[model samples]
Target: MFAALSAIGAFIKIPIGINSAALDTVPALISAAFLPPVYAGAASLIGHLSSSLYAGFPLGPLHLIIAVEMFLILFVFTKLHQAGRNVWKWIFFIVANSVLATLPFYWIISPAFFVMALPGITIATVLNAGIAIVVSPVVERVMERVRTHA
Candidate 1:
C-alpha cells in the first residue's frame, strides 16, 4: 500500500517554478497519521528512494537526504497529532520541512543537474511548503473520513 501510494505520488507533480516542484503529500501524510512514526518514516524514506531511483534522479546521497527530510516531517506530524494539535501544527510542519529539507538541495545540489542558478533555499522551501500546506488538509480530511467509515 505504501509503495503504491508513493509511486502514484511520484507521477503527480505540480510544477511551481524552476525552484519549487510539488508532489502530492497525501501518502506521506496518511502514513504519518495512521502508522507509528518510525514505521511511517521508514516507509516514506524507502518509498521516496525507490521513486527517485526509478525516475532516474540522482540517487545515493540525495536519497539519504530526502529520507532524512521525510523522516523529520513524518515524525513531527505524528508527534503533533498525538499532542492534539493537528491543523496548525501540520502547517508549521509543512513549512519547516519544506524549507529545511529542500533548500539545501536546490541551492547546493541541483546545480549539478543543470547549469542554472537555483532559487534561494528560503524561496524554494516556502513555495514547496506552501503547496503542501494547501493540499494536505484536504487530503487529511478525506483520509479521516475513509478511516472512520472503514
Candidate 2:
C-alpha cells in the first residue's frame, strides 16, 4: 500500500537531459524508513519502471540504470535508519550512487557522460534526499502505528 503511494509520488517529472528528476527518490526513502530495505528497492524498481514506462520513458535501458541507482541508495538508507543515524548521510549516498551509476556508461554512453550528467543527477538526487529526510520521521511514525495495529 505504502509502496503504491510512493509510486504515485513518482508521477511528477523534471527531465534533465536523458535522465529525469521524477521525484521517486523520496517515496523510495519512505519505503526504506518504514519498511524493509528489500521493499524500498522493490518500490523503487517498480515505481520507476512502471511510471517511466507508462509515460513513455525514452531512455530505454538507461531507466534500468537509474532504477538500480535508486535501489542502492534507498537500500543503504534503510540500514542507516535501522541504526538510527542521521538522514544527511543520504547526500553521500546520492552522490555516490550517481558516481557509480555514471560508470560503464563512460565507455558506452560517452567519454564525457559522467562529466555532463553527474552535476544534474547529483543535484536532483540530493534534493530528493533532502525531501525524504524531512518526511522520514512522519513516515516512520505512521508505519509504526500501522504495524502496531495491524
Candidate 3:
C-alpha cells in the first residue's frame, strides 16, 4: 500500500519547477504519523531512494540530503504528536523541516549542483515545503478516518 501510494505520488507533479511533486514528502509524513519514528524514517529513505533510482536522479550525495530531510521531518512530527499539538503546529513543523532541513544540504551542494544560484534551491525548498504544508491536513484527516474505522 505504501509503495503504491508513493508511486502514484511520484507522477503527480505541480506546475511550477520548484520540484513540487505529490510524491516527495507525503509518504514520509504519513509513515511518521502512524509508525514509529525509526520505521517512518526508514520508509522515507527507502521510498525516496526507490523513486530516485527509478526516476534517474544523481544519487550520489543527494541520498544523504534526502536522508537528513526525512529524518528531521519524521522526528519533528513524532515529537509534535507526542506533545499533543494541534494541526497548525504540525504544519509549521513540516514547513520548518522542509526548509531548514534542506538548507545546509543546498548550501553544501549548490556550487556543484546549482552553479552558485541559490534562488533555485530556495524556490525548490519553498515549493516542496508549501505543498507538504498544504497537503498535511488532508493526510491527517484521512489517517484519522482510517484509525477510527480500524
Candidate 4:
C-alpha cells in the first residue's frame, strides 16, 4: 500500500541533483508512524527506486546507495516515532533527507553538483516531510478505525 503510494509519487517529481525529489518519503514517513520499521524501510527503498527508474536511473548503480540510505532513514524514523521523539523525528527526517542524503554525492559525484543540488533537495525534503507530518495523524486515525472494525 505504502509502496504503491511511493511509486505513484515518483511521477510527481521535482528535478534535483542526479535524481529528482518526489513525495516518496511522505508515504514512508506516514507508515513509520504506525507500521513496523521494516515496512517503512521497504517503502522508502521502493520509493527511491521507482523515482530513479522513472528518471531512467540517472545515477546508474549509485542509486542503490541512495536507496539504502533511504531505507536506513525510514528505519531510524520508525525508531524515533516508537521512542516518542516527535520533534527529533521531524528534524532528523528533514536533515537526513536534505543534507545527509546529498553529502555523499559531494565525494562520489562532485562538490559542484552537490552545491548545485542542495537547495532543491532541501526544499523538496521540507515539502515532502511537511506534508507527511500534516497528514499522518489523519491516516493514523483511519488505520485505528480499520483495526478496530476488523
Candidate 5:
C-alpha cells in the first residue's frame, strides 16, 4: 500500500539539478513510524526506482545506487523511530538523504551540481519528514481502531 502511494508520488516531482525532489519519501517516512524497518525500506526503494523510471533514468545506472541508499537510509530511519529518538531520526534523515545521498553524485556530476541541489534536497527532506511526522499519529490512531475492530 505504501509502495503504491510512493509510485504515485513519483509523477509529482520538483526538478533539482540532475535529480528531483518528490513526496515519494513521505510514505516511507510515515510507514517507518509503525512498520518494520525492512518494510519501510522496501517502500523507499520502490519510491526511488519509480521516480527514476518516470524521469527516464536521467542518471542512468546511478539511480540504482540511489535506490540502495534510500533503502538503507529508511532502514536506519525506522530503527531511530523505534528507538524513540525523534530528533535524531529527523537529523539522520536530513543528513543521510539531503547531504550524504548527494555527495556521491557531487563527485560524479560536479561540485556545482551538488551546491545547486543541496537547498532543494533539504527543502524536500523537511517537507517529506514534516508531513510524515504530522500524519503518522493520525494514521496510527486509525490503524489502532481498525485493528481493534478486526
Candidate 6:
C-alpha cells in the first residue's frame, strides 16, 4: 500500500531540472520508518523508479543514481532518531546527488551544465527532506491504524 501510494506520488512532480526529487519521498520515508530495512529499501527503490518513469522527470539514466540517493535518504532519515545520529548523512546526500545525478551530463554535455543544475537539485533535496521530516509521523500513524484495522 505504501509502495503503491509512493508510485502514485511519482506523477505529482516538482521539477528540479535534471535532478529528481518528488512527493514519492514522503511515502518512501513513511515505509522506511515502519518497515524493516530490506522491505523499506526495496520500496524506496521502486518509489524512485516510479517517480522517474511516471513523471518523466529525470530525463536520462542519471536518474538511477538519484534512485540510489532516494534509497539512502529513506534509509538514513528513518534511522536518524532511532540511531540518534547527526544530520551529516542528510547533508551529504543533498550535496552528493547534485553531483551524482549530473555526472553523465558532465560526460555528454559539460561541467557547466552540471554546475548550472546543482543549485536547483540542492534546493529540491532540501525541500523534500523538510517535507519528509514533517510528514513521516502522520503517514506512520495512519499506516499503523490501517494495519490494525485490517
Which lDDT values do the candidates have, in the order given?
0.61, 0.73, 0.59, 0.89, 0.89, 0.67
Q: How would you encode candidate 1's per-residue C-alpha lDDT over 83-136 as one tens digit per residue?
A: 878676667665666555656666656745333423443443455445656766
TM-score of each: 0.63, 0.79, 0.62, 0.92, 0.91, 0.69
Candidates arranged by TM-score, highest first: 4, 5, 2, 6, 1, 3
TM-score of 4: 0.92
> Which residue pairs come into collision in candidate 3?
none
In model 6, how large is the Cα lDDT of residue 60? Answer: 83
Sequence-dependent TM-score of model 3: 0.62
How many collisions per candidate? 0, 0, 0, 0, 0, 0
Off by over 4 Å in 1: 19-24, 103-150
Worst 10 residues of 5 by lDDT: 14-23
Model 4 Cα lDDT, one tens digit per residue, 43-144: 999999998898898789999999999999999999999999999999998899889999999999999989988998898889898899899999989988
Worst 10 residues of 6 by lDDT: 81-90
Model 3 deviation from native, Cα RMSD in Å: 4.0
- Whole-model lDDT, candidate 4? 0.89
Residues 62-133 of candidate 6 have per-residue lDDT tens digits of 677667766765666556634645366456546654556556677677888767877876676677667876
Model 1 error, position 115 (Å): 14
**Candidate 6 lDDT (Cα, 0 to 1):** 0.67
Which of the predicted structures, 2 or 5, would earn the higher lDDT when compared with the native?
Answer: 5
Candidate 1 whole-model C-alpha lDDT, 0 to 1 = 0.61
Model 3 lDDT tens row, 49-135: 665665667657676677667665666676666576757545755455545655665566674454333444355445555665677
Instruction: Give the winner by lDDT: 1 or 5.
Output: 5
Rate residue 16 of model 4 by lDDT. 69
